[model samples]
Target: MSIYRTIGIIGAMAEELELLHRHAQMESETVKAGLVFYRGTLHGMNIIAVKSGVGKVNAAVCTQALIDLGAECILFTGVAGAVDSSLTIGDIVVSTACVQHDMDVTALGFAPGAIPYQEISVFPADEELRSLAVRASRDAVNGRVLEGVVLSGDQFIASRDKVQSLRDVFQGACAEMEGAAVAQVAHMNGIPYVVIRSMSDQADGSAHMNFAEFTVLAAGQSYAVIEGMVRSLQQA
Candidate 1:
């Protein structure tokens, strides 16, 4: 049996969380701290899922609520903009580390990505969970599955310049609004966490249009990978 009695899953968008909730067995909902939490079972595992609204603060609040609700581990799955030129829509990025691209303190001698009082700029994902996710992604999606850095910020990345700037600084595979914040909170709480993102658009001028067209499709791809990972953990 899995060691974790309760697993927490978070998504930035309603579409992503809603799909998972639909697949969950014996699901029930509760509202707390302006967020809705869904308690359920998937692949015979007890799970709590939440749609974290949009940004870092929302993600952090939802994560903490999940922890308070008895989650032992956390998993974040959502859609992202491709930061790398090689990544295409539907490609999955299982984050090895997450960094906030907007956290800048250069005037205070801290590096651009560094958080105040934190030694490392990047927060790492749980190794065991990441491995399971990578394996599951390979089986779930026909496109490439990569393990790399995911950069997060409050702004939606929709320009080539912004993408290039983030890549130059963090060397990230994907860019999103919530993953790094969730990672930071999990790290502080000493909880094992993992982030899975499916590319919904290239962070370019066309990003808005691309995301509008592919968000649902990308969310489905991410959900498939997460489902596979849950099954793997269940059998283990």
Candidate 2:
């Protein structure tokens, strides 16, 4: 038996979700709100996996739908661009916290990245889940595994200046298009959630080329980590 009755797993790309789907047993799928949710069991745990389209709005929508369907917790797995230069392709980053790098409202006197009513920027991941992710990454990933803040924005970071700017502001390990938005939605709903990512690029001018060449390898690394996490939960 698993600790949670039902877990929600979300990814922005088809490749990410496909890997999970292939591993699922007794799976059934339903489409709603332009997203497809796959309900099944993985490693003895009940799961709902969805391929959320790219970007923040898409991620939030999928998360809310998962919540409406009675998901107790959410897990996001995908590839990210490395914000810290020390990170390399296939290295895993398990998010300890998440922030929307594009959420700037300084003109309204709110600090950059702060939500108007919340008056806060960074949102912490669920400690228990983050810890489990770290352990799983250590067990499964071949490259370095790190736990740090992850920044999300609509833009795909592909320039040195943009990457440096985000790192300077958020001090994050990785940058992606959707993680922070999913984190915010989960936070508001009082659901525990964690974000796990594999670095596919350095978030520099060569990012696009690097991503195209290494995304498959990075995704495989992330999938292994996620599998290890599910196994850990099943045993726990």
| TM-score against truth, every candidate | 0.97, 0.96
Lowest summed lDDT window (length 10), candidate 1? 18-27
Query: What does candidate 2's lDDT look like per residue over 66-143, in tens digits?
Result: 989878989899999999878998899999999998988889998778878884567799998999999988887778
Q: Over 4 Å off in model 1, which ranges?
A: none
User: Candidate 2 — what's its lDDT?
Assistant: 0.87
Candidate 1 residue 42 Cα shift, in angstroms, is 0.9
Clashes of each: 0, 0
User: Which residue ranges in model 2 land beyond 4 Å of their true spot?
Assistant: none
**Candidate 1 TM-score over all chains jointly:** 0.97
lDDT of 1 at 112: 85
**Per-residue lDDT of model 1, residues 18-114, tens digit only:** 6787788856888999898888899999998888989999988988898889889998999999998889999999999999999999899988899
lDDT score of residue 29 within candidate 2: 80
